[model samples]
Target: MIAQSAARHYANFKGLPKGRSELEESSLMARSTTLAFSGLLLAAAPASALARDYLVHDQKEYRAAAGAVKAGDVIRLAEGEWKDFPILLEGQGTAKQPITLTVQTKGKVILTGASSLRMAGSHLLVSGLVFRDGSAPGAEVISFRRDPRSYARHSRLTEVVIDRYNKADRRTEDRWVSIYGSDNRVDHSWFAGKGNLGVTLAVIRPKGQPEANRHRIDHNYFGPRPPLGSNGGETIRLGTSDESLSDSANLVEANVFDRCDGEVEIVSVKSGANVVRSNLILESQGAIVLRHGNGNRVERNVFLGKAKPHTGGVRVINEGQIVRDNYMEGLAGTDFTSALAVMNGVPGSAINRYHAVSGAEIANNSMFEVARVTLGAGADAERTAAPTGSRLTNNLITGQDGKPFRVEADMVGVTFTDNVTDGEVPGAIPSGLRKTGIATKRAANGLLYPTDPALAAQGAPRDLRPVMVAEVGPAWYPKATGIAAFGSGRAVPVKAGGLEAAVAAARPGDTLKLAAGHYTAEAPLRISVPLTVSGPRDADIAFSAPTLFQLEEGAALRLEGLSITGDKAPRQSGNAVIRTSALSTVANYALEIDGTAFSRLDSAPAFDLIATTPGTFADRIAITKAAVNGLSGAVLAAAAETEGKGRYAAEHIAIADSRFEKIGSLAQILRAGTDESTFGPELILRGNTVVQSGPVMLGLSGVQSILIEGNTFRSSGRIAVANSVGTPETRIIDNHFIQTPEPTVTKLYPQGSPRVLVSGNSIGGDAS
Candidate 1:
C-alpha cells in the first residue's frame, strides 16, 4: 500500500494541475499520505522514542526549553511578539529526526526590535516566524553560524520572513541573513525591505575549511528594495571578494526576485561551481552578474523586465561560465542587459577587476524585445582584452529594430553558430555563419510570445507554462508547465548627438548618453529641468570654461557614469565644476550625482551653491559611487553670504560609497553653517575612503543629525567637527582613522548638551 501511495505521489508530482487551489490541495494530500506512512513505521517503536514537543511562550521559557531539547524534539513558539530577544539555538539531531523550532500558528508570531537568531547545530530546522519593523543593529537578523567555534551543519531555515530589519541609522552595514556552514538549506523564506547596507542573503565560506559550503537557497521570495545608490547591496551574494577564488558548490534555484533593485548586481556569484537556475526576476534593475567565479552555471531562469530601464539580463565577466536555457523579455538596458554582455577584461587584472572570459558557453537562450546584445563591452578606453575560446550557439533573439548583436572591433576568437534572430546581426559575424532556425515576430496583441507558428519553438520549452504567483515566493507550488512567460515591453534609449544638442533635444525623464569621447562645451550649460546625463565608464567630459554646468531654479540633474575633468589651466579665476544659482521659490530641490569622477581642479569646489535667497533650500544632495581627486578647495560649499530675511539651508546630505584622495587645502571638504533659527544639514557620510593631504574639518554649525559610520580616513592631521549650537545628534561610530590624530568634536554649549556618541572607532590604524 505504501509503494502504491508513493507511486501515486510521484505521478501527481510530474503532472500537477494548473490552478492554485488544485495544486495546493494536491500538495497537501501528498504530504499527508507521506506523513501517515511515516507514522505507521514509527508505531512499532517504543513510546519514549517518539518525537517530543515543547511549547515556549517567552524568551525565558524559550531559553529553558532550548537547553532540554534533544533529537526529534519540536519547540513551538507561542503566538506573541518577541521583542529585542536574541535567540541562540544550539542542538544536535539525526538526519531523520531533526530538531525543529516553529511557531504554534504560522504568521502569528512576530519577532521585532533587535530580535535575532544565531543557530549552531547540525540537522536543525527553523520555520514559520516573522521578523519585521525593527533592527538587529550590528548583527545579522538570522545567522547560521555563531562566534568562537560554533557552526551549523546540515541545517535548514524555512518559511521565515525578514522584513525591514534595519539599523538605527539606516546606513550601518548589517546583513539580513548570513549563511556560514556546510550543506545548509534556506528555502521557502521571504526577505524584503532590507534598507541597510549589506547583502540581503550572504553565503560565506570560511578559511581553512576543506569542505565546501554546499548551501541550497530555493523557493524563496526576494521582494522590492530601494536602490542603495552604492555597492554592497546585492539581494544574494555567493561569496566575498576575498573568497572569490574559493569553490562554494551552492545552488540557488526556484526563487522569485520581485523588483529587487538594491544595487548593480541582483545576484552576485563570487565563488566557483555554483548553480543559479529556475528563478524568476521581475522588473529588477540589475543582472545576475558573474563577477568572480569560474565553472558556474546559470540556466533555465527567466528575466521579465517589462521594459523597465536598467533592468538587465545575464552579465558574464570571468571564464568557464555557462549561461544557457534562459528566457528574457522586455529588457531596456544597454551594457548591463544586452541579452548577454561578455565583458572585456583588463590585462593582468586582479579578482576585483573584470577577468578574462575564456571557455564560456552561452547557448539555447531566448530573448524578446531586448536592447543591444553585445560582445566585448567596456573595451574602448579601458582597452580590456577580448574574450577567447567563448562559443555562442543555439540562441534566439527578437527585438523591434537596430542591430541585435554588437561586437567590439577588438573581439576575437568568439564562435557563433545556429543562432536565430529577427533583427540584423553585427558586422563582425560573417553573414553565413549562423544557421537560423526560426523567423520570430512579436504577437499582434502585444503578448510576450508570438502567435505565428514559425516562432513558436524558438525560445524556452514549448510545453512550459507562464510564471504565476503560486509558482514563486515562499509557498513552493509545483509548476504545471515548463515554459517561462514573457513580460510587457518598453524601451528608452539615449539618442546620439553632441553634448549640448543631446541635452537640448532631451525631454524630462530622458537620459542623454555620451559615448567615449572628449566633449568640451563652449560655455557653461544651463540646465533648467529634471534630466539625467550619463555616459560610459571611460567617457571623459572637459570644460573649456569654468562652471561647466549651471543649475537654475527648479532644475535637478542626475549625473551618472562619467569622468569629469576640469581644466587645470583655468579659463577664468575662481572657476568651479558646477554652480547653482539662488532659488527664487521656497520649494526644495535636489542634485544626485552617481558613478562620476571629478579631478584636476586647481582651486574650485565641485559644487558651489550660491544662496542669494534665504528662504530657498536644496533638500537632498546625494553624491554616491564617485571618485574625486586633486581638489585644492572644498568639495562642496554654501556661499558665505545670504540674501533676504529668511534662512538658506541644504538639508539631508548623503555622500556614501565614494573615494576622495588628496583633497582640501584652502577650505574644508564640506563647509556649511546654520544660524540659530534654522536647522542645518542632516548629513550621513558613510562607507567612503578618504586619503587627505591636510586636516579634514567638518564645519557643522547647526546640523540636525550627523552619522559618520564605516568610513576610512587616512590623514596625518587632526580631524575636527565643530558645531556652533551643539544641538545636532552626532554619532561617530565604526570609522577607521588611519595615521590620523584622534578626532575632536567641539561644541559651543558649555553645559555639554547634545553629547556625541563616539565609540567603536579605531584611531591611528586600519579598521577592518
Candidate 2:
C-alpha cells in the first residue's frame, strides 16, 4: 500500500503551502495565493529551469531533491562530499518568492550529520554550503528550531559553511551554529571547529518568550577553537541564558575573529538594541566580554590576543553598555589563576551582567605595543593597576625602555587631559642613582658643559665655568631673568656666610624674598636647585629650626608663600616642608597652598614627606592656592612599595585651589606604589576645601586618569574615595560631598574595577 500512498501525498503537500510557507500565510487571499504560486515558478521556468540543480550522490538523492523544491527555488550544490543525513529543507518561500540553497561550484561540500541542516520554515536561503564530517556530539551544524508543525517564519544562513561537519577526530571535533528563529541573516559564513560557541543565539523556553528578535551577523569569519570548549575569546554570542526570554534585537558587524574560545556574552535584556562595530581580533584567548544587555554599542574594534589576567580588553557587566572607539592590544597574564571569571555579585551567571555601566564612552583607542610584564610581575603591575573611569582621553601608551609608563590605576571619575609619554625614565627596581652637581672642568664645546645643558645630556660630568650669576633677587638672578643660571659652577665659599651673610642664606635654587617683617632661622634650609621659599606679601618667614625645609638628594622643591612655627621634633613633621633625600628626582613635586598654614605638622612623630620613588614624569602632587592648617601624620604621603611593581608613578598632576582645614590621622592626598608606565597618573582636584581631613580625600593606591572636578569635602575619613586596587580607573566628575561622610558610604571597591565614571557628583554622608 506504500504507506497508503504516502499518506495521500502528504495530504496534497499540506494543501499546497507553496514556497517559503507563503510567508506564513495569514490569509489575504492566502498571501496572494502564495505570491501567485512563487511568481508562476519564476515566470514559467528556463534560466536553466529556474535554477534547481541538485546532485548529491547519496542519502537517497538527498531526500529526493528535498521533496522536489518549488516556490522560487534555487538549490545548487553540485561539486562533492556528503554524509550526515537530514537536509529537511522545510521549503516554503514567498516574501517575494525566497528559497535559495546554494553552493554551485567552489568544491568541498561536506554536510555529514546525525541531525543538522534543519531549516524549519520561512523564506529560507542557505548559501555557499560546506558542512563537514559532523560528529554530532550533541548536534546542530546548522539549525533554525521553532517547530510545532511550523510553516517557516524567517530563515537565512548565507555563505553557509559549517566545518568539520560532525567531528570525529577531524582534529578533535567541535563545530556548531545554532539560531532560534526570527528574521535571520547569517552572512558570509565560515565557522571552524565550533560550538559552545562559534555562533550561538540561545533562548530555549524562558516563559512568555516571543522575541527571538531580528538578527544579522555580518561579514563572518570565526576560526580556531576546540582546545577546550568555551574559553571565552568570542566570535559571536548573544543570550547566554537569564531565561526571561527576550532575545530582543541583534546586529554584529565587520566580524573577523581568529581563535575564539569564549567570553562575548550578552544575556538578560527586558529591552532591545545591539551593535558591535568594526572588528578584527587575533590570537584569541579572551576578549569582547559583556553582560546583562541594554542598548548596547561597542565601537571601532581591533583587539590582539592572549588574554587571562582576568582577561581584559572588554569587560562590561551590563547596565546600559556603550564602550566606544575600541582598540585593545594584549598583556594580562601574570598567572595567579582564577578561572572562568565573572565578577559583580557572582553566581552561575556566566557573562553579560550589568545594572550599572550606565552610558559608557571609553574613547580614543591606542593601546600600542602592549606587553611590558616580561616574565612575571614586570612593568610594575601593568603600569600600576590598569583601568578606571572609562573616558581616559587620547591614549598612547608605551613603555619597554621606549619610555613613558606611569599610571597608578585608581582613576576616580576619570577625565585625564592631553596625555603624552616618550618612555624610559622610570628607575628604582633594585636600582639607585641620585647625585646632581658634578663639574671637574673641561669644555670648549667638548660637550660636557655641565651645570645645565639640561644637566648636560643626562650622564652628567662636565666642567667649565665663565658664566657667573648668582645673586638672588633682581627677580632672583638666573641670568637675572634670562633663565640659564641653575647653580653655575665654581663659587665655593659659605660656611660662615659673607656676601652679605650669604645673601641672607636659604639656598636650594635660591629665592628668599622675605620683607614684610618676621624672620627667624635656626638652621634648616638645605635644598639643591628648585626653590620658591616665598615671603614678600606682608612677610613672615620664620623657622626656629626643628626642621623647616631640608631636601638634599637631588632636590626639586617648591614652597610658595610662608608662615613660621617653633619647635617640633620627632624629626620636624611639616610646617614649611619640602624634603627629598634617599635617591631622588623630586619630580616637579609642587605643594603650593597660597594662604599657607599648618599646625604642629602631625605633632612630629615622624613622616609628613618621605619621597617614595616612582616616576615617569607627569605629576606627583600639586596643591594650588594652598592652605593646610594643622596636619598630623598625613597631609600627603606617596608610598612606593616595590614588589612585582606598580602603584603610583608621576605623570600629569594638578591639585587646585587647595585648603585642608583640620587634618588629623591621615590622607588629604596620598598615592601608594606600583607604576610601570602609561603616563596618566593624573589628578585634578578643583577648588578644594576639606574641613576634617582623615577619612580620605585622595588615598589612591593604584591610581590612573584621576580627576575629581569641583571639589568640596567636609569632615571625612573612612575610605572617602579609597582606591581598593584590583584595577581602578576612577572618574568622579563634578564633585561635592558634605558633613564628612563614609561609614561605608560607597566610594569605590567594586571588585576588579577598571572603568568608573560617576557623573556630576553630590553625596550627603554623616549619619554614622
Candidate 3:
C-alpha cells in the first residue's frame, strides 16, 4: 500500500530564472560531492538495498543515471525546464521497496517530449515534473509497456504538467502521457493541448489476454492551449481494443477541463470498474467514453461554456455505469451538454440482438443550453435492443436548441422525472413560443414550463432557477431576476386558448395563464410573440377539447399551464383509447409546450390517446409537466406519413413530466414514411415516469432521433418501444423497469435503425 501524502497545491510564481548555466553549476557541485560520498558508502555493505539518488541536469546525464540505477533506487532531477528529451525507466522492483524518479524543485521543471518514457517495471514512482514540447510521431510524452507479467505496480506520478510549450508533434499515436500496466496512481497533474488524448491508459498490443491493470488519475487539469485552436486535444482515456484483450480498472476524479478538442475516453475492457467524480469542464468539445469492459461511475462534475458552443459531451458505449449529479451549460448555440450519452449497443456480439443497455444509472443532473442531452443512431443498431435497466430523476434543465433529450422507444426499463426548465430571454418573447408536448411518460416532482420565455428574446442572459423546489409552497414560480416577469410591459400575455391566442394577441413581452384540465387537443400550438404563462394547478383549466384543442397554423405559440395531456382525442370507436393520432392538423404550430402535466388517472379510461396524423400538426413543440401516465393510449403519439414527399412532417419536439405509466400496445410511439422527405424529425423526453404497456408500448417510423429519460415503467409488453424505417437515432435510457420480461423489454426494426443505448435505469426484470 502506498503511503498517502498531503494534497499538493500550486500558485503561479512570476520571478523564476530561466537560465541553464545556474542549473548546470548546481548539478556539477551536487554530483561531485555525491561521487565523493559514493566511494565511502560503497566500501561498507551498502545498507538499505543498495540505493542511490543521482542529480541529473541534462538529457545525457539523466539517461545515464537512469540506466545505472538499481531496482530499489531513485534519480532526483534539479529544478529547471529541460526541453526536448524523455527518459525511459525499464526496470523491476519488488512491492516492499520500489524505485522512485522524482523532481526536487517545485518550480517550473519541464521534460520535453523529445522521446517517450517507456516503463517496464514492477514498481516506479514519478512525481513533480512539467513535461512540454512534445515530439515523436504518435509517441506519448511518457508511456509504459504493455506486459501482462510485468507492470508498474504501486507506482505514483504526482504534480506533473504536460502541455505544448516545447513543441507538439502531429501524430495520432503521440499523446501527452500513456500508461499500459496497472496499479499506478497519477495525481495532481496538468495536461493541455497535446494530441488525440491528454493521458491514455491502454494496452499496446491492441489485443491480448485479460490482464488486470488498475490506475487512479485524480486532481488533474485538462484543456486547450492558449490562443485557442492551437492543439485540438482530448482529455484522459482508459481502454483496450480487441487487438489487446487486457482490461484495467481505473478511477478519474477531481479534474479540471478548460477546453479540449476530443472526448475523454473509457473504452474496451474485459472486466473493470472506473469512477469519475467532482471535476470541472469548461468550453471543451466533450468527453468520449466506453464502459464496455465493466463497472463504472461518473458523478458530481460542473461543466460550463463561454462564447462558443461545446460540440459534444460524455459518450458511453457498451458498458454498465453510474452517472449522476453533474451540471452542464452551453452559453451559445444550444449544442452542448450530454450527461451519459451511450454510443454503441451492448457488450457481447450476440447479446446486442436484445436491444438493451444493461446496467446503468443516470440521475440528479442539471443541464442548460444543450441542444440534445443524448444521441445514438447507426447501422449496427438494426434489430438491436435499445439500452435497458436505467433510471433518471430529479434533474433541472433549460434550453432546447437541438432537442432537450432523446431515447429509443423500444428501450426497456428507462425512467425520467423531477426536472425543471427555465430559459433566458433578451427583453420579450421572440417568434415561436408555444411548445409541443412529445409522446413521453414520467413520475414525481417535475416542473416543465417555458417559465420565462420572453427573458431570452434578443440574446438575454440565461434564466436559471436558483432553488429547484419550493419547500414551503405547493406551487413554484420563477425566482425574481430583478427583471419584471412582464418585461417592462413590452411583452404580451399568453391567452386562454393554447398558443394561437398568445401569438396573435401577445406583444414582445407578456405573461399568460393556463387552466388545468386534460389539455391535449390544441395539437400544434404556435406563437410568434413573446409571453409568459403562470397559474395555480387549480386556477388554469385547459384540455385538448376534441376538435377545438387542435392548435392553429403558422403561429409562433408559447403556452404554459398545469395538468396538460397529449392523449389523442376520445374517438367514437370502441373501448380502446386512440393510441395513434386522435386529433391532427393543428397546422404549423411552432409552439413552446410548457408547464403541462401528463398522466393517466386511475379512474380514467386506458386508451385515450394515439398518433394518427402521420407527421402532421405537432411541429416544434416543447413539453414540460409535473407527471405523466402511459395507460391512456401511448403516452405521446407521432404521426405516420401516407402521402407527399415532404409536405407535412413533424419535427423538433420535447416532453417532461413525472408519474408516467407504461401500459397498452403503445406508450411513446413514432412513425414515418420510407424516403428522406420524412427525415429531420427529433424528440427529447426528459424527467418523466415511464412504465410497461400492454403489448407494443412504443411504436415509431420515419424520423430522425428520439431521446427518453427519467421515468419508471411497469414492464409487461411486446417491444416496450418499436420504431420503423427513417428512424435515425434513438436513445432510451435513465428510466426504471420492474417485473418486465426480457422479450417485452425492448425491440427495434431495420430501415432507420437508431443507435440504441439503454443505460441508467433500475431494472428488475427476467431477461432470461
Of the candidates shown, which would achieve the greatest TM-score relative to the real structure?
Answer: 1
**Candidate 1's residue-wise lDDT over 1-768, tens digit each?**
443353234223322132213323533553464454244223312223676778899989999989988866778899989898898889996555567788778778989887889999887778778887688845688899778479888887877888767764433578889998787877667887765567899997665653568787776788876555335668999986667776788878767888876666899998888888767888887889898978888877788898876688998988799998788988876654566788778788877666888899988788887876878865643435789998887777876464667776355568877677777766688742343434444443223554557546555554333344464444522222211111111113442337877665555456676777777776877766667778887778877766777776446677889988876335445566776653333223567889999888755543222222232346567889988887765556543323321133464678899888776631232223322222335678899887864565344444546788998878745656665432356789998888867777876543213548999998776523
- Candidates 1 and 3 compared: the better one by lDDT is 1
C-alpha lDDT (0 to 100) for residue 552 of candidate 2: 52
* Candidate 3 residue spans exceeding 4 A from truth: 1-50, 58-64, 79-86, 92-97, 107-109, 146-150, 165-172, 195-206, 225-233, 243-247, 263-271, 311-313, 331-355, 375-384, 400-403, 417-768
Tens-place lDDT per residue, model 2, 471-580, is: 10011111102111223322323222222344334454555444456555566666555445555334544455555565553344454565544334445444434444
Location of the lowest summed lDDT over 10 successive residues in candidate 3: 5-14
How does each model score on TM-score?
0.59, 0.26, 0.46
In model 1, where is the ten-residue run with the lowest total lDDT?
Answer: 482-491
lDDT of each: 0.67, 0.45, 0.45
How many Å off is the CA of 507 in candidate 1? 32
lDDT of 3 by residue, 448-562 (tens): 2233443222111122221211211111111112112233344333334454555356654566554443233343333333345555555433334342233322234344555
Error of 3 at 591 (Å): 39
The reply for model 2, stretches above 4 Å from the true place, is 1-98, 101-118, 121-143, 147-156, 159-185, 188-235, 238-710, 715-726, 729-768
lDDT of 1 at 33: 42
